[model samples]
Target chain A: MEPIVAYSLVLSAVLFTMGVLAVLARRNPIIMFMGIELMLNAANLAFIAFSRHLDKLDGQVIALIFMAVAAAEVAIGLAIIVSIYRYRRDVDVDAVNVLRG
Target chain B: MNVIELIVFIAAAALALVGAAGMVMSRNPVHSALFLIANFFALAVIFLLLSAPVLAALQVLVYAGAIMVLFLFIIFFFVQPGQKHLYVYSLPWQTFFSGILVIVLICILVLGLYMGGVFTAEEHVQSAAMKVEELTSPQALGSALFSRYLLPFELTSLLLLAAMLGAVVLARKEGRGDMEEKD
Candidate 1:
């Protein structure tokens, strides 16, 4: 049956939407970081789905790489957020302008 | 439909959705971190269903297990104001963009289901890439990872180690020998 794949696509869609909402709705720097992770995860799900659709393992490989990068991003991101908070005593990203272009 | 996979699929989807909701809704940074971990676990289940045993294992080991633990540790040590801090939301355009995106995704999913596509091993990569019984046994995936994809695997692990070191360096206040000492 195609149910599992269908289910997966739907799940991925839901996850993607959730990520969008998180990125849109969060004000805390850490929470925004989490939102970015969610978005990467949604892309990973799509990668797996397309890999299956194409009958190859390549998508899985790409997804694996993405996950690793996501970890690095989050680690570096939280560290930056922490340092910023330490200096300014707040993590409200909207108000910060130290590194903005 | 057999019971277990269906149950797992449903549970995983719910876990992911609720975890995402919690991450967005929680005022406390600690709670957001916790929910993000839960979301990772839910994703591991979805990966398992795709028949990529290696991905599933890594999903749990790397995302839920190691990385999230680091996030929580940082929050515990450094996010003191997380408790009493005020929360802010996204800009108006962001919400509008997200709303439009959700509507498009729903339409796509509905179309996919209505197409009533057939399944075959030779069919485009579709479900056959991970047809649990024949293709995606742990043995099969493990061998593939170690054999064909070995170099990438080694590099990924190396990247992970680098990320850990980076976190330690960034989190600690000192620059060199006094590294462990916090300000």
Candidate 2:
């Protein structure tokens, strides 16, 4: 068995789960953003792993593109957070529950 | 089964996991971002061990070199670090509950292995590192990207361009009334 590769894949899944838990469990906006980043990187790790296992560069290319998308996500997300902060002075997810429709 | 490769793999994995844990645990967004960068570096090192130097190079350049800098800049410049701390969860039980959830998730993962993935061991003749030539050569990657993956490649570039525009528009400094009104 290629234990290393398996372990990395499993770890990637574990981290993705952690990131999911972070998003679900935490109520802070910034913390949620961090969790989302964790999830993105977790998925990226899987991409790299599959790329290596297949002996192809496809996963690497996807991972690069994913990084770009993740960066843009943070940019837009942080901007939204800033705008929210400007009005309420807090990034608490619970407090901003007015749009709870 | 070589001692050196084993040591390297274990070390890279350990560093990555430690930094990952720290990023999740830290309250400071800046610290979390920094720890994530550390985790990214460890992952890139592991990619090197897997003989994907191009992937590893991109991991360092695109992840550590570029994206993280964007994160740090936003956190530092957009928000005042000293402004009163804005903690979200008020109850201590929230943390305790999440901890138990992590434990349960781990159990499920272990059970997943027992259920199937080992059922078949198709002989994989190609060594994990089939050829250093495939991984290291820009020519190989270029042809693959431009030939086999041309459509997806162009699509991804367009997607990135769209994302940049969306990010700028949403994060714009002025005329954020819609957001402010909701806040």
Candidate 3:
């Protein structure tokens, strides 16, 4: 692989790992949502890099779809967070245990 | 590649990593959101370097512009004034296990890349000679998105509509009160 591709892939991997750490370690819903976004972005980077590597347009198209899906996810997720906060007065994942038996 | 391209790539990659680290390490949700926006910007530059200007533009417009704004709004709306303990990491075991998982994943990625001949000098020449005339332009991407991927494109629009309606229903205060009164 080219140096650029290698660098991008490594960066994507590092970012994805950091995102996982954020999602696992943080209790705040917003921060966890941001982590998910970071992972998606990392995947997008890998997609673009491979698309360039293979000289194809499919990867870019897929990346576009991923972005659209991410936007939709954020819309629904934030709305859920807001509703949860309205009833519970906090967005911490551990604090909202209404479903716990 | 050239000296300038290498330098740019290194700078962008460094910025992206820093932003990612900051997003994970910061205690303030607003700060984390800002860091994520910076990371998205750096990723857009990297996308440009990868010869996908359309993706780069979309990264800026969608992720940095729209999504980050939404995040900031939600952060300010939900977080109360004078709330000191905004971020509490109460799960140490989860963090420890996640740390182990991250290390393992990184090891696997590096090993896979090395074994896949990604670092080989032979593939560099082939990658350099790749045809740029087809996949690098916005027009080409538009054609592919419309003709070849028409179903997915239309489906995405439907998904967006559903998400919008769901957001409205979930966040509506009167709807919540009606459910409470009925119960």
Give me the candidate number with maximum lDDT. Answer: 3
Which of candidates 2 and 3 is the stronger one according to TM-score? Answer: 3
Q: What C-alpha lDDT does candidate 2 achieve relative to the native structure?
A: 0.73
Candidate lDDT scores, in order, read: 0.75, 0.73, 0.87
DockQ of 3: 0.72
Question: By how many angstroms RMSD does model 2 differ from the true structure?
Answer: 4.3
lDDT of model 2, residue B85: 51
Worst 10 residues of 3 chain B by lDDT: B121-130
TM-score of chain B, per candidate? 0.65, 0.79, 0.87
Candidate 1 local lDDT, residue A27: 66
Q: Give the clash count for model 2.
A: 0
DockQ of each: 0.47, 0.47, 0.72
Q: Write the per-residue lDDT of candidate 3 for residues B1-183, one digit (tens) a residue.
A: 789989999899889999999998888889999999999999999998999998999999999999999999998888975575544647668878888988998899888888988777554454454476667879999999999999999999999999999999888785436766753
True contacts kept of each: 0.45, 0.35, 0.82
The TM-score of candidate 3 is: 0.91
Score every model by TM-score: 0.77, 0.83, 0.91
Better of 2 and 3 by DockQ: 3
Order the numbered candidates by lDDT, best leading.
3, 1, 2
Residues B106-178, candidate 2: write the lDDT tens digits.
7787577546463335566566444546775667777887888888778777877777787777665566476
